[model samples]
Target: MNPYFARSRNDRLAVGTFLFGTLLAVWYLMCVVLPHYQLSSDYVIYAHYATMTILYFQSLANFVMVTVARPDGNCKALQRNQQTESAHCDACGIVKPPRSHHCKVCDVCVLKRDHHCWFAGCCVGLRNHRHFVVMLTYLWLAAVYGNVLQWTFVGDQLGGHGPATWFRIVAPHVALLTGHVTAYQFFVAVMTFVGLLCLVMFSWLLQMQVVQIYHGQTQHERETAVTKYDLGWRQNVTCALGSRWYLVWISPWIPSPIPDDGYEYRTSAKTD
Candidate 1:
């Protein structure tokens, strides 16, 4: 009930709305409006339209899941006299299970706490980590797809005019918003730039997540050099991504069963 926790949650909701709206707007303009306007002969725009829509909704659904799913903190059930090894959370005056850590921003201890993500406006902990990862994967795909489509549209615009014509079109728009270009053209150019930026940023984040899964480490554990839960690669992946791991990327609605209840985890003695 900390004020900051409430503020962070609100911040994440706003971010989610902005992200979803921007992506959807760009996809609509690029995949539908531009193709129809140009009387595009290529059939790929039709296919891209469907694919982009799927990716957009899938990403948005998972984003909502991650935002709403709260971490399993030190609850009353775990607080009772249990033999399981646990730590005391002074802030909440409760017993925290192994691997759980206190989130200062959330003002609560989270099970398998990774980190608080400002973008998602939630703690990336046991309950929502899979959703977070899947969301990123889909969003990254959307960005890549948008970039390709927009680039192709730019090429079509410049056809027979040569590369130099890009400046001729964009330079006038920059100064006076008057040019040989339509509004759709300006939109495509802006979306292409944004897509490239997202691609680079998300690519690095996705790679880091993959590495952490492979090594059986959370962001917090990686920082601490702790690898007690260093199960084999397959187990580690299932632990984080759930049983239906292969289908997680395809859609967010798929049921991905986490192997163990968040309270209990199988660990190895080795620390890497």
Candidate 2:
């Protein structure tokens, strides 16, 4: 009944849903769909698969980083300032550094706390923010690519590309029970919807994160129009991501470390 625990509980469900959906979608694409093109002597699928493989693996790596990286404000800087300053987090018993906030779910104060990602079951903060954004970007790209590859196939299976077929795709359960669609058809319908939904969701998430980073703001700071930290978009990007912001989308293994610890920040009034 405790409200504080609800988010954590939902975090578990979110993790399960994310993993299950990802696995199912991957199986459909790699096993079911790719074989379709292969059997038809469509060797061109190899090129498409290679790209999808890259995007999927890159996104997966960044996803792991976002979940595992600790951006909590537990370093010597914040730890030494345990005095009851106005920015103090009583729960963490430490004076939070600039842009830091306590995460009840993680039970720690996150440096430059953007927000909690329930599906990842981790706080997106200074350390993982770059990975989080990259994950979303790759996920969105893969989803868009997958949708383009599968749309024609799905339309054919549903009996042509028409609104009538779309209605059946939308009401897949009904089509399945009514014997209008096979079990495979039903599953494909659901997965099709899932792919589109993931594309749309990731699109919004990527846009939001990029805009916030572009303006040197977190989700909270964005709402407040906090322009003090609004260095040029390029500087803001390098601040959140790293000096090599342009190259992060290529891979997370690249060692592009942020310049400083999360303890201090530069303001627009003093970019020196």
Candidate 3:
């Protein structure tokens, strides 16, 4: 019996696959179903906005949850102590690089370890964090914007009725948009959905910008122990989303690469 199979590798693959499937299912339902049958305009709009907010919150929550390490104490102090070139992770038994954390489930030290995402069915580590973010941005907008478009179709289907019969006529359009869709139109539907998704994600990304301006923290700084926020907001943004978030799509946030042997495990030092 191979020990690696019984350890992190198998669990990671299984759990990761489950998460990926779940996200795919959700994407199908949100982007495909509701839009096909023509759900309510308000519902579609609300879902879009809600998804945007939720993604932002989820990203923030996931980042904070994993990187903070000991959420109870002065993480600042622990980080300060780790200022030397390298250190070990007590949990996963590896010497983590400067901004790395050990993931117990994956049983490896993930560089720039954000939270493990069930949506992508992968750890939001250095390798795929950007992809996951891009996916979220796409999914959120696809849900909301797509729904709004559906409402337009529903309205068109109804041919613009007046106040009295508007409610009655519009209600059916909503129902029709909600279900009975197939995979073929997915590409066409995704075009519209992706556009809206990008718009909303960009807007929220800007919002994260404004918040960071006042608080003076990057996504990376907020998550890890690299606390030199004095280097202007531009640098902070660059560090957070890479030097090119404003330029391209699809998880442009690039993380620093991890070392060859990976992080060392340090015994949790008992503080008196």
Predicted model with the maximum lDDT: 2
The weakest ten consecutive residues by lDDT in model 2 span 1-10
Which regions of candidate 2 deviate over 4 angstroms?
1-7, 38-43, 82-86, 270-272
CA lDDT of every candidate? 0.73, 0.80, 0.44
Model 2 vs. true fold: TM:
0.89
What total of clashing residue pairs does each candidate reach? 0, 0, 22
What ranking emerges by lDDT with the best candidate at the front?
2, 1, 3
Query: In model 2, how large is the Cα lDDT of residue 119?
Result: 86
TM per candidate comes to 0.79, 0.89, 0.42
- State the displacement of the C-alpha of residue 263, model 1, in Å, after optimal TM-score superposition: 2.2
lDDT tens readout by residue for model 2, 1-272: 11222247888899788768777777788887777654554466667668877887887798887877776745567778643433877897778887888887888888888998888888888988889888888888889888988887887778887886777677888888888888888888888877887888998998999889888999878887777888888889898899988889888978777875787777888331
Alpha-carbon lDDT of model 3: 0.44
lDDT of prediction 1: 0.73
Q: Write the per-residue lDDT of candidate 3 for residues 1-272, one digit (tens) a residue.
A: 11212244655575465445435534644565456555568876576557645554454343332332231122333344444566766874444465566556545555555555433333554444434445455445544544454555434443443552244333433333654222333333443344444457556764554554333343555544334433455543344444464642522333432221112322222221
